[model samples]
Structure formats: structure tokens, C-alpha cells
Target: MFWALFLLPAWAVAGSACLRLCLAAVRAAATAPEAAGDDRALTLYEAAFLSGGPRRVADLTLVSMARQRRLLLAHTGWATVVDPRGRDEMERSVIGAIGPGGQSRIAPVRAAAAGTEAVRGLADRLVGAGLAVQDGAGSIAAGVRRVRLAALAVCALAALALALPVPSDLPDRLVALWFALPLALTLGSLLIARMEVHPYSRWASPAGQRLLTALTRRPGAPADDPAQLTAVALLGVHAVGEPDLRAAFAHRERYLEEPAAPGH
Candidate 1:
């Protein structure tokens, strides 16, 4: 029973590799644009995009409401903040998830302001970072496959050792602890390998959520997410023809077009 524990570190290493691979698989497999599900990072982009508005009384009121929710979520500090030290630190810090299950949003002053270049820059950076993460997921998936094969070999060796006839004088406690720990850790690692966060689901909600909408949309998917294509389509439009990310600066056009009132 304890044979698995001695290999705990190796199992954890293998597990993290598999976790990365599984997440990569999800990123690769998720092709349905409309079917994208909710995620903390995607919600951040959405919140930032919506903050740029007509600045009407009603919009301000909505912002106030969102703020109250933010306050409540902050009270517990249970939100999902991505790697603060990552290359995309600006986007991650400016916008993040809050509340239980991290259902709400927080915005950076730059993204929230009207007629600012910062909003567009943020969107471009977010899209770029998101694409990188998705690609990394793919790489990790390949790495996991290799690690699993190696793990099987290790397991076999450990099993053989376990089966070998031993002198009766060996301490039972030592035998149990050595193998049991690694196996338990390995099993736990396997469980963590299955986390799924649907990035495309960012578009499903529309309450001040343009960033989420734009980032998650995969508008041109063929039958069955063919060819594993990836595109960043923030807002209701895809950035495909935007030309060198200059389109990010153009988000002000949409901000200027907002209705005089929120929800109008």
C-alpha cells in the first residue's frame, strides 16, 4: 500500500506536467465560439472593456453597483488573481476576478477611463497573452504524454520491489511509509490534471463585457473546431484584419459610440 509514497516527488513532477497537458488539451479542444464558458481571467478582460462608457448617470449607477459587489468580494479576498509576476502583469492586475467562485470584476483606471489609449493597449496585450497561454497549453499536453509513459516504467519497478521476498525482520512501519506516500501523492496529482476553464465562454455574458466577448469569440470555427485554430476577437468583432494591433487603439471608437445611458 505504501509503495507509491516513496515516489511522491516524481509523481508530483509528473502530475504537474500532466496538469499542464490537460489544460492545453482543453484549450486546443474548445472551438465552439458561443459555447465558451466562464473563467476568472476572461471576466477581467470583460470588466475592463465595459468600464469605458458614455459616463451617463445610469452607467455610473451601474458602475456603482459593480463597485459595491467588488467591495463585498474584496472583504474575503478570495478572487483568482493570475501570476502577478507574469509578462502580462498589467492586464492581470488591472482586471481580476472577485466574489465567491470569482464571479465579479475589478477594473484598472486606465481601462475604465473614457477616450484613453490604455484601454486598447490593454486589450491587445490581453489577447496576445491569452494566445500564448493557449499555445503553452498545447506544448504541455505533449510533455504530459511522455511523462505518463515514463511514470509507468517507474511504477513497474516499484511494484517489483514491493513483490520481492524480504526478511521478516524488516520494520513493517518503514515499509508501509516508503511506498504508501508516493502512491497517494501520485493519485492526488492525477486528480489535479483535469481542471477545465472554458476561455471562449467569456462572450456568454453581456453586462459590460466587451473584453470578454472579444477575447473568447472564435467566429470562424469549422465543423468540430478543425485545424486547432486560434484567434482573438474582442468586442463583437474579430481582430483578424486589425493590422499589427493598431486596432487596439481604435477601441475608443466604440467607447465614443456608447448610448447616453447604461443598458440603453
Candidate 2:
């Protein structure tokens, strides 16, 4: 039948989406985190990286230093070194990122600090510990991207099928409905992923995510401390409950925070 011509690409779209979803499942299973059960409790830096990757870690450091009177974070989006001496490697990285002038916009500082060796080393440790996704297509985030692309493919295929000058007596509604099946397949998969994977899929492995929930939910949350690094680490600047703090980090530059694509 002439209608079979459009049907072929429709099948291709469905098949492609199915294949990609299957492969993603396999990868997710392979990477599924088994809790280490040591209860060692992640450091603030570690938790920051797991929660929102490098930028979060950098933010935690900046906020921590600011609270300790070592840095000044102005609501107008500037960072000034109050105490040039950094308390740790992470703080030192931020100081260096601020450059020789010791004063810079928060955006450039956040960007540079996020790309530092300290952040990469942190990512490596978390990846080794099964706490964060690898930064590439093998990751769940990448799988989602591929599935989205497949949905687009379905749309394009459907368009081509409609554009063809085929002689068929099929009703216009039926013809349109015919192509909706595969498109729905791919879009449906995305919806399922959003429901199932989402927040964890972005940056953390299952075990890490579980631990994070526990830590934040526990009595006297690690964040409850006066320093509050844990809060910022887990929830970004919003955790600070300070409008000035939020505005300071809000001017973040969109570069190098997560370099190897959206898999995180």
C-alpha cells in the first residue's frame, strides 16, 4: 500500500527511541549506586558537588568564606577578598580565580572557580565512589537528550510522510493519527524519565541522592551549623536565606562550570 511508505519511517522513529531507551536502562543499571553504608558523612565540598556539581561547590566555598568574614559578597554582584588567606584548597582556588586584583565580578569568579583543578579532583573522587554520573553520553542525562532527539526525529519523519504526494483514500484525521503513535512513544518515554529519574539524573547517583536526602532531612541538619556550608552546598545560594547572598551569586557566567556536557 502507498500508505506503507510513511509507516516505514514511523517505525524507524519508534525503533530508534526504543533502542536508545533500552541502552539507557542498561547503563543506568550498570551505574546504579549501592550505598556504601559506611555513614562516613560526606564533607561539605563533597555534598556540594553531588548536589549541583562544581558550581555549587564553588558557591559553598564562597558563602562559607563570606560568613567567616574572609570574603565580601555584595548584592551588586562583586566579590572582595577581606582576608587574603584561604582556609583550604577550595578557598584558595576561589581566591586565585578572583585574580591578582583580589576584586572581581561574582560571575567570572564563579565560572573560574568552578573549572579549577580542585573541582575536577572532587568530581573524580565522586565518580570513583559511584556518587556522580560520568560526564558524557553514557550518562542518564545524555540518554534523555538522545530520547528528546528521537522525538524530534519522529516529528520530522511525520512531516516528510505528510509532504509525500501519496494517493490514499484514508481520512485526513486518520492519516495524522497514524504518525502520532511513534511520536507519542518517544514523548511518553521522556515523561516517564522525568517522573522517575529527574533530579538524580542531573547530577547524583542513587546512593548519593539517598544520602543527601537523609542528611538534609535529619534533625540538626548538617546545615544547621552556624557556618551553613552544608545548606548552601545542597540547595545553592537560596539556602542562605539572604537576599544579598542570592543576588551575589545570581550573576553567574554560563561557562566551564560543567565542561563535558549535560550528563553531569
RMSD of each: 17.6, 6.3
Pull out the clashing pairs in model 2.
Answer: none
Please state the error at residue 159 of candidate 1 in Å: 1.0
Off by over 4 Å in 1: 1-129, 134-138, 166-177, 197-264
Q: Assess every candidate by TM-score.
A: 0.27, 0.78
Candidate topping lDDT = 2
lDDT of 1 by residue, 145-211 (tens): 5446545645664565557665534465565455555455445444454343322232122211333
Off by over 4 Å in 2: 1-18, 32-38, 136-138, 145-149, 152-174, 191-199, 223-225, 253-264
Candidate 2 residue-wise lDDT, 20-77, digit = tens: 6667656555654353433557888888887888988888889988888899988667
Error of 2 at 87 (Å): 1.6
